[model samples]
Target: MLMTTNEPQSILDRSGMTNAEAGALYRLLTWLSPSFPVGAFAYSSGIEWAVEAGDISDAVSLRGWLAALLADGSGFCDGVFLAQAHRAAETGDDGVLREIAELAAAYVPSRERQLETTTQGRAFIEIARAAWSYDGLDLLIASCGGTIVYPVAVGIVSAAHGIPLAPTLHAFLHALASNWISAGSRLVPLGQTDSQRVLASLEPVVAATAGRALLATLDDLGSATFRADLSSLRHETQYTRLFRS
Candidate 1:
């Protein structure tokens, strides 16, 4: 049987949309782009403190710090939140979405960390609303009542726009790693080549975290990077600072 170009051949077809026009790759790239104006470059996520404390003084140390984050720290927690929020959005569960947002906001271990996520989250929502406005995301933001966490915002928006969950989480983690690497580069004074090498070595960690996050729930969320959390708190009082947190 000959099928028309727009006709579905199987029940797996969703909304008669073709994979070629799904726009997942383009949306992910644009939303995560450095120039997206979410102010991602202005925050260090405590890398500033880590550098000052000599915890991340070289490319090797930087990789280790980020690996912990990806494997079992803020990255792990955020990835879980992102996945749950994505599921909530996918299921049209405003209650679950709100719960996730509230929990994520309250889970931060320090004031600076809170500021980092909330501030960036607000900025991300603003840009997304202004540029990539969508009803699902609009409702999610409206439902949050002005307190959305960064990962939640990213998750809701991605799910609302039909970006698959795993890739969205992967892109989120990669964007995070890239931002931290940029900060480490300036702080550790690593050359461009070394920075690239560090990111390359951590690819497996990022992939593994994303995979785990896809199947993880709130129960799976936890951070073992106590010192890293402390660095964020300490960064709040660090006399000199190049980044916000």
Candidate 2:
């Protein structure tokens, strides 16, 4: 049975969010969920090679690797792109949005890395358009043209649906960290508790990365995680592999 209430106090919680805000939050949760069918699990973002190379054999090392990624590598670069795309879409500036999308597509460091982001990017656009779209989501995506980078796709969708960028950035980074941590868990064969510990330890790194990305401009996009980049390249020819990248 459903109970209807006219009182805002009765319907709303201490957070004081209106129904629109609450619904927007729910959409973010759904779009970024691990089971959202974007094939995120198929890509490890180089964790597979990191494990094989013994760079991530334990929780502490795993945390460190991810911290670098969040602070200086794809995490930071992608976040910048995401923010740019979000603001561009929010302002109805397709020119800026298209440029950001192109940069993200060209920013990948390896063949498989490009495959990983763009493949998921295409899937996210198609899935969201089919099930969760607004009037402008498809238009923004179509305007961007060519291969849509995943972060750009996410940013566009977030803006199109009126989801605020701060929480969206945090959630997006958190989800990326979670997926990579999951890959690390399987490859390192870590106990479930250890995996949780690794993820727990990355909170500050993710928060700081999201904060930087919130203020970042396209000019700030770059990466210095050379070893991590090599891992993605090495994964291409590794004798045995379980991840796409």
Best by TM-score: 2
| Clash pairs (backbone) in predicted model 2 | none
lDDT values for all models: 0.87, 0.91
lDDT of 2 at 84: 90
The estimated TM-scores of all candidates read 0.90, 0.95
lDDT per residue (tens digit) for residues 129-193 in model 2: 89975887877987797889899999999999999999999999999999999898888888889
Backbone clashes under 3 angstroms, per model: 0, 0
**In model 2, what is the error at residue 212, expressed in angstroms?**
0.6
CA shift at 39, candidate 1, in angstroms? 0.6
lDDT of 1 by residue, 1-245 (tens): 97566444342266454664455677789888777888888888899999999999898899999999889899888999999989998888888888888999999988878888998888877887788778667777776656898999899888888888888899999998999899999888899999999999999999999999988879878889988988999999999999999
Which residue runs of candidate 2 sit more than 4 Å off their true CA positions?
Answer: 1-10, 13-15
TM-score of 2: 0.95
How does candidate 1 fare on TM-score?
A: 0.90
